[model samples]
Target: MPHLTIVANITAKADKVELVKNELLKLVQPSLKDAGCINYVLHQDNVNPTLFMFYENWQTRELWQEHMNTSHVKALNEATEGAIEHVSLQEMTGIE
Candidate 1:
């Protein structure tokens, strides 16, 4: 099966930017250790500090879904409640 690519765009409430970022950062090391993870990288918008993005590559769609279902991810959801302005997730394939 082909690898899966995910683009996760997160926009935080002005006052909650740092909180959101810290929570998101906590996911990195654990996420990278997942069985199917290829590379999980985070980025912050240079011009817009409240904008955070993730570039994740997984071995399969199922594994990516598993990543989302993890306990830490669930906690993250709870921790960031009402602190996020927007979230956009895109599942992608490599054409080249």
Candidate 2:
């Protein structure tokens, strides 16, 4: 199987890093159990306090796209509306 890796770099504004971390942590399970998701993990940058990373794995690209359109995704998008500086996402594939 060709596993999917989603790399997300998130920046927090207004010193809201902790707040966003807490919010995002609360959001982990919903995404974890979503249809094609194999794993969903979140981490904070050591040097850059305001930066966060989310590494998500999925069974397929199509299912990952579906996960992005779910209601929980919408809620997350809304949660970070004013508190986030920027978010960048990159999709990659695992290699043997």
Candidate 3:
């Protein structure tokens, strides 16, 4: 089976960029340790400091969903409430 790829784009509220960034950073270590996680990398836009992106690869869609339900992810949601301007997510499978 092909791996599941996730591309998540996040835009932070103008005043809350650093807060959102710190909260997002807290997810990295735990996500990397999650079952079936092939890789989880975070990126920040060069031209827009308030924009952030996560490029993730998982063994399966189910495992990626599991990662989304993890405690750390939950905490991230709670911590960033109202601090985000917009979020977009794309789930894809690499074409081999």
Candidate 4:
């Protein structure tokens, strides 16, 4: 069973949402191929063009921590540096 769940809330620059989404897609597709990652998804709110949510499921907290330290993930963080106004995260544990 997956041990850690990650959720990230993102907001992008006004006209750069599409571009941000594209970058996120590129970041996540490769991330999902990692053994530690179970899934990675980005959700855009219908009412807010600049708002997005990232949900990632990891095989273990250790692996998730490792993922947080990876270059691609770090690049993704830097990629959105000035493009985002707010960034928050929530992590949950599955009972199963």
Choose the strongest candidate by lDDT.
Answer: 3
Per-residue lDDT over 1-96 for candidate 1, one digit per residue giving the tens place of the 0 to 100 score: 679999999999999999999999999999999889999999999999999999999999999999999988999999999999999999999988
Cα deviation of 91, candidate 1, in Å: 0.3
Give, for candidate 2, the lowest lDDT window spanning 10 residues: 14-23
Model 3 lDDT-worst window of ten: 40-49
Estimate, for each residue in 27-74, the C-alpha lDDT of model 3 and write its tens digit. 999999999999999999999999999999999999999999999999
Greater-lDDT candidate between 3 and 4: 3
Clash pairs detected, candidate 1: none
- Residue range 5-50, candidate 2, lDDT tens digits: 9999989985787778877887798999899999999998988888
Among the numbered candidates, top TM-score falls to: 3
From the highest lDDT down, the ranking of the candidates is: 3, 1, 2, 4
Better of 2 and 4 by TM-score: 2
Error of 1 at 18 (Å): 0.5
> lDDT of candidate 2?
0.89
Which candidate model has the greater lDDT, 1 or 3?
A: 3
On a 0 to 100 scale, what is the lDDT of residue 26 in model 3?
94
Candidate 4 worst ten-residue window by lDDT: 77-86
The order of the candidates by TM-score, greatest first, is 3, 1, 2, 4
Colliding pairs, model 3: none
Model 1 poorest ten-residue lDDT run:
26-35
**Residue pair clashes in candidate 4:** none
TM-score per model over all chains: 0.97, 0.92, 0.98, 0.86
